[model samples]
Target: QEHGVSGMFTAPTAIRLLMGYGTEPAKPFDLHTLTRVFSAGEVLNPAAWEWMQKQLFHDRVPVVDHMWQTETGGPVFANPYGVSLLPIKPGGAGIPLPGIYAEIRTPEGAALPQGEKGIVVLTRPFPGLTPTIWADPAYIPHRLNGQSLNYQPPP
Candidate 1:
């Protein structure tokens, strides 16, 4: 890289778009300075992740997928590349970050097993979670009345 950029954070849609251009367009650039790649906003499909890992970077860097929400403030599930390098799992939004109490549960509040489809719920409030949604005073009571904020993970 001309400017020695070390990392990149992008959306999966951008990666898929770049993938359509193929690997040839990337050959002219020296990307050795890049150390890691991050994806958010949407689920990163295995096919797109594979192309970025094997074809684009040739396994030189880890293409990490993470997920967050505006309500939660920052990333709740991530690879923690800065802490420890975990094994890359294509299409997975890595393990929960430290201090984040997260679990997948059924509609009736029963915890779901691993690999099961359910809503993602935060058992406790974490730092940075907005106490109230701005300009929506009525919605705050409903959200904070022991009601789980349901986030259905992609199938």
Candidate 2:
């Protein structure tokens, strides 16, 4: 608040800590200084999302969620902020960002239709990706070959 911070991207745990701090005994602080909060790295349960909305910001600031990992180097499923501000679904990660072609597949690799839970996979390349693992450069590619898959990360 001292620095006039307007937005932040953090894990759900951090938000929960701030929520705890705002309660009695601790000095009361207004969250209106914040305009947006982006969260990832864990499931933002519906109950927590509800608390973030009703109790945290009074439903004024948007709590956005996305899915990503160090390997992806960027978000595969995220709200396209610059393109447009889409509606928030309490516990849903927004649709795939432009240029990202992702799909869900069973443990055995068969594709599953939308709304079915499965492992997420990226079938196409995008920006900011490492081509090979650091420890074993040939391991990932060789394993893909053994599995009859040719998954290429972005250059």
Candidate 3:
């Protein structure tokens, strides 16, 4: 209407809020200026992506999927925009971004491989990562029985 803007970075929930307000995303809008869109916090569905693309992209609007728990403060793993995305499956957290280390482990402390989901572990501790429960920051890192998670202070 007045000031023209393009591209948006927000969560899937927020996008739904805008659509609920009766904003017609398709038909007519200066969508060409829009180049990118991102959704995180939860998951991004293909249906939602198609709707948004109609209203926002005349060409192609890359949808960057991100994943990170509050414990990580923000997205530590994300699909870089404009890159090859394996193709959006109905419900799936896209592969980790470059350099993100993810480990799937079990209560017994053995690492699980792909095609198996287990307790998630990180090889490198993110500075923003909360290492322990509240008021127990100094708790020692050890396995429940034998193998355990490893932790080390940065040099």
Task: Encode model 2's per-residue lDDT on 1-155: one tens digit a residue.
Answer: 67777888888777666666553532366555788888898767676777777776778888888888877887878777667889878778898876577899999999999889999888676544655544446645564666533445435
Score candidate 2 by TM-score against the native. Answer: 0.73
Stretches of candidate 1 off by over 4 Å are 130-155
Count of steric clashes across candidates, in order: 1, 0, 0
- TM-score of each model, in listed order: 0.81, 0.73, 0.61
Q: How would the candidate models be sorted by TM-score, starting from the highest?
A: 1, 2, 3
Could you list the CA RMSD of all candidates, in the order they appear? 8.4, 7.8, 8.3
* Rank list by lDDT: 1, 2, 3
lDDT of all predictions, in order shown?
0.83, 0.73, 0.61
Cα deviation of 45, candidate 2, in Å: 1.4
Q: Estimate the lDDT of model 3.
A: 0.61
lDDT of 1 by residue, 31-123 (tens): 989999998988899999999999999899999999897777889998999989899889888998865788999999999999899999988
Which residue pairs does candidate 3 place in steric collision?
Answer: none
Q: Show pairs that collide, candidate 2.
A: none
The residue-level lDDT of candidate 2 at 68 comes to: 84
